[model samples]
Target: MGDSHTSHTGVRFELLGPLRALRDGVEIPLGPPKQRAVLAVLLLQEGRPMSYDGLVEAVWGGSPPVHVRNLVQKYVSGLRRALGDGPLLEWTGSGYRLSGAAVDDLRERRQLVDAALAARDAGELRRAAELVARAEELWRGEFAEGLAAPCLAAERLRWSEKRLSVLEARLAGQIEAGRPFESVHELVRLAAAHPLRERPVELLMLALCRAGRGTEALLAYEELRRRLAEALGTDPGPALRSLHARILRQDPALLAEPVPVG
Candidate 1:
């Protein structure tokens, strides 16, 4: 759950940003693009043996070359060499399995997020914020940025959504702990980045109102309303509209620390 690197003696695989491998502190040079893609497929299904047909489908999609099985074998050979003598990869007669204990940043991030949610449920606001903050730090960039395999698209989207959810939770926790001013800047940026996602915009408005900047909060809502009308042809949802109305009347409830939700 907590952030951790792979152990010194075990194989460490990184698939969150790019495909990387290390063993005992020495970097293993994964071969060319297709080879690395093969490694990704294997690592994504670590202990399970992926069939040759599955590997072919993952690496080449619908346009496999003639003698594609031979090509896949060659890639596997290169990966084995890159893996050195770690016995991490094994052939299971029908397919290959990547064995041994492996550390993955994506898995670790998921764990941290789970821990953060548990902390929040227990009313440990500060601990939840810290845990989600740690989880957010694991994302270096887009998932497997340079990997050109079609098979990674679904996983990439899934992980990206999880990351955004963690960000939203972290920001909400910060605002709920009587530190709306501390999160105002971040909420502003998040709202700008995702204009259609009303949660961040709502949070930004609440933080601004709580910070005694009611005018700016109103302006933020107006800008978002304009954008939404232009882009989606819809008014702000009920939650956001309610928040806007509350801010307009300087509702006393806004002065107290309230968890902003949309």
Candidate 2:
């Protein structure tokens, strides 16, 4: 079913970090890990019904408690009590739905990402970088960190990759907006953190070349090439190889201002 709340829910939720519910800026005690997992699924559902079977699958995976329905009812009661006023979590005859929740960090991050894309499309590169940076600040830690459900683990992995993608976009925007020097150190850290990941290395190479450190850029490419060959018995892909060649030829195009990063 659709949402019940016609207006703001007053309860601000966070699933990007640990699952948290805040009412009037005060944190509510959401009980145990399993209990928090229930909230995680509900928040992700966004006012849609979470059927008992769906809840069992999401919260307990393949080995749910024998008393699943009764356990769910108890969990819901605790959640309702913690939420107190305004926000409502109710059984909808068919399933459970939460209403009156507002401004979840997950949605907040999406909003910022959307704004950044709009700014980028408008050619407001600096504004795009700033908006993406704000979105990056939304994560206190990994999304729904350590809750045991397989579905949530999949969500965590997806969010992790998305965070990396956004970081790449933000760094790329900085380079294209005439701020390559500022992107180098962070790109360096990003490359080191995910050695097998190629985009950060690609951006790192571009940033170094743009900052007039062409020699270092070539070395960065060589390092990635060596790492890839040794680990996967393969070479850097075509785009990265082409970039390496461009840097080597001192492709004056590389020095040209506002070259979009690969």
- The TM-score leader among the candidates is 2
How far residue 126's Cα lies from its native spot in candidate 2, in Å, is 1.4
**Model 1, range 7-123, lDDT digits (tens) per residue?**
343667777677778766566899898888888877788578888888788878888989898888898888888787764677789888877635478678778888988988899
Candidate 2 per-residue C-alpha lDDT over 185-244 given as tens digits, one digit per residue, 9 for 90 to 100: 999999999998889988998899988898999999999999999999999999899999
TM-score of each: 0.89, 0.92
- Once superposed on the true structure, which residue ranges of model 2 sit more than 4 Å away at CA? 1-7, 257-262
Shift of residue 250 alpha carbon in model 2, Å: 1.5
Report the lDDT of model 1 for residue 167.
87
